[model samples]
Target: MDIATIDRRRLIGWGALLPLAALAGCAAGPGGYSLDEGVRRLLTLSTQRAFGRLLQPGGFYEDQLARISPPDAIGAGGPGRLNAIFGAFLRSEAVRRRVSLALNDVAGRAAQRAAPYVLESIRGMFTADAVRTLRGGPQAATDLLHQRIGGHVVEVMVPELAGLLRSDLLSALSAAAAEQTGIDYLELGRTVAEQAADGIFRVIGREEAAIRADPAATRDPVLIALLRR
Candidate 1:
């Protein structure tokens, strides 16, 4: 339909599916900067985080970002099947403070000095893959993730890891919310907006699929509001 209609849903889809979608096609890169060092470090970080999950029961809080969290939606086994895409994100990015604090503690110690660059490199890889997978561009979907990372550094890595880091920081997000508030629209709004403005990025994903099924059925006025801004 109109641009606004598309945007409202995109905001939510932006929140939810984008993160997981990015992850699924993440390593497949076709363009972007090169940080061989960063990729190596990320592999280390990823493995370390996976190890943490093995040692802990809760697995770093909620099941989304934790190692125990569901597999990337793209892989053979994941949360829900990849369906239609939708996204919702409140305008605010700073909805959660506690989660931000936890980023430093992701490894149970000071973040390694080399980790940021390493993570950045990994992010670049993911972004390139996203462009190929989602955009269906000249870059085929089956390229080196590193090449893509080198190609689309800022667009992919910045936003992608921002969410991942937020997830890491908010190790207690779901738990804390359940404990303090009884889960209301207001809280959930904050949760969704904060995480990705996508309702913890999950509902936004669901909405995207809905819109594709029946755009007329996508009846949230907020979508309109999101578009105008």
Candidate 2:
């Protein structure tokens, strides 16, 4: 058989097997979890993995996949833009790296704070409205996650981030910022927390999309089965 024919046969086989897997998982569970429960568990697992990856050393600051930098709050044609004006040292590679490290540190701290609450928050997201949207497409669950729990994550995250900001390489960032704005550490900490929270959510959403697109990634046999349905 040609490549296309072989691929087609494999697809057919998976389609046939997936529902059986789902049924087996759902039926054999301790209390017989609902399909929504299965989906929620899968999403929680995916989100945990996705955010956890970002907390590793170099995961955010050095990994090309997750690295982030300070926002360009400065706009075009500003004094700093054309004249290479004051505080230009803040843009130095060293300063940028320090800032990046600080941001990543804040994210890691925030993520740790958010961890215990993550599953519960996600479980709560499957409201009637959200369940209806889940059938919309791959992004529905993630969208609901953001809409429902994003703020809570940020709220939980910011204070932890703020606390850590002073200790986790905060001095380096503070020094960098001192040159520019005397470093409103709390305000800066909040911004960092918000950005980090946003980044983690984005990562989790991407992971959810991946699992939805490829049912096998759900890993739970029941979840795979439900996806087939």
Candidate 3:
């Protein structure tokens, strides 16, 4: 099923989404092209919106997509450093504000860019029984959410923010290590997002290569043969 087809309204019932609205206008542009610039804008908006949702009342409390409430397998010192990392990452004063703004932007301006691609990511989400791509551990799933949606957001939003604030975020990311306080949610997110982005590019490359190598394999071979005649 398509991500868009997933009961977005039902998400509200999950009681984890809060009352958020998407921003922007329209899903695509001329010839349905999702220009890089447009995609960047939408990515920014969508990520911010997701961030806001995490902050909303019970926002990141229980939603499967963004849950951070740790797992039993990670009880206390049993997991050692891994357990502490999630805690440090979770303490995000900077993320609290920026993420909140971004989430709202996404809710309001969902279509201003390319909904199909985002939706594609959500929909393609293991529409089959696949192995867990990575061990997110406790709240790793929500971390996945951030990764899937963060960078495009950074690409668009970092430019809009003051240089100082941008520096702070970069700083926060850098200082994520030695997170003696708790899990470095921001850093954790960066790692996940980076990995996801890599996968996305790989898929795109493979598809492009396949299409170039055998147009017929990627298209309706019967139709292509008839056209050749």
Candidate 4:
């Protein structure tokens, strides 16, 4: 079953049942749930929800905020005449759309593979400042998560995205662009991977903000309890 589909009541009951001793190192907040655990749980839920949306077809392609565009350098040529000629071809809307679609496809798959790494990072996250994180802005937890592991997650995704970009399917799509502009597929892969990682965090941050604004709407007792404090 999808983690996003898990019943809220079950999660609430489970959280309520957790022994305080199990969370010994962390400081407890209201209703026996540690602020650290609360922050962790919130980040976990946000990450899961972000991945759930991103794993879908057209997740990146259709999302205006998440969609990958052709590199700006493609349209910005240097002083050389030869560079100007190549830049014009690379700037074509058709070329940009084709490149973006390929990048989005690769980003979706790379994200699928990177999900485990992201979750592992979240699980190992240090919540030494949980109270400050919880009390800060809506995206405070997400900002902290990114500061801690964003680069690592992007690194984990790079090779996977690069591999996909080199696959037969993408290679076929890239052939025309390559012949016309000598586009560097490897660098493109890295750019898309980084952008994809950013998009994932952006979605997670949005979820964090929404949840904070109305924790009761989530119906998760742990979140509600944490917010109350």
Best by lDDT: 4
Q: Cα RMSD (Å) per model?
A: 19.6, 11.0, 16.4, 4.9
TM-score of the candidate numbered 1?
Answer: 0.18
Which rank order by TM-score, best down to worst? 4, 2, 3, 1
Scanning candidate 4 in windows of ten residues, the lowest lDDT window is 73-82
Would you estimate the TM-scores of all the predictions? 0.18, 0.70, 0.26, 0.81
* Model 3, CA-based lDDT: 0.34
Candidate 3 minimal-lDDT segment of 10 residues: 127-136
Tens digit of per-residue lDDT, candidate 4, span 12-75: 4433443333267678777776787778778877777677677777688887657776565522
Q: How far is candidate 1 from the true structure (C-alpha RMSD, Å)?
A: 19.6
In terms of lDDT, which candidate is stronger, 2 or 3? 2
**What ranking emerges by lDDT with the best candidate at the front?**
4, 2, 3, 1
Candidate 4's displacement at residue 62, Å, is 1.9
Give the whole-model CA lDDT for all candidates, comma-separated.
0.29, 0.59, 0.34, 0.71
| Collision pairs in model 4 | none
TM-score, cand. 2: 0.70
Best by TM-score: 4
- Candidate 3, TM-score vs. the true structure? 0.26
TM-score of 4: 0.81
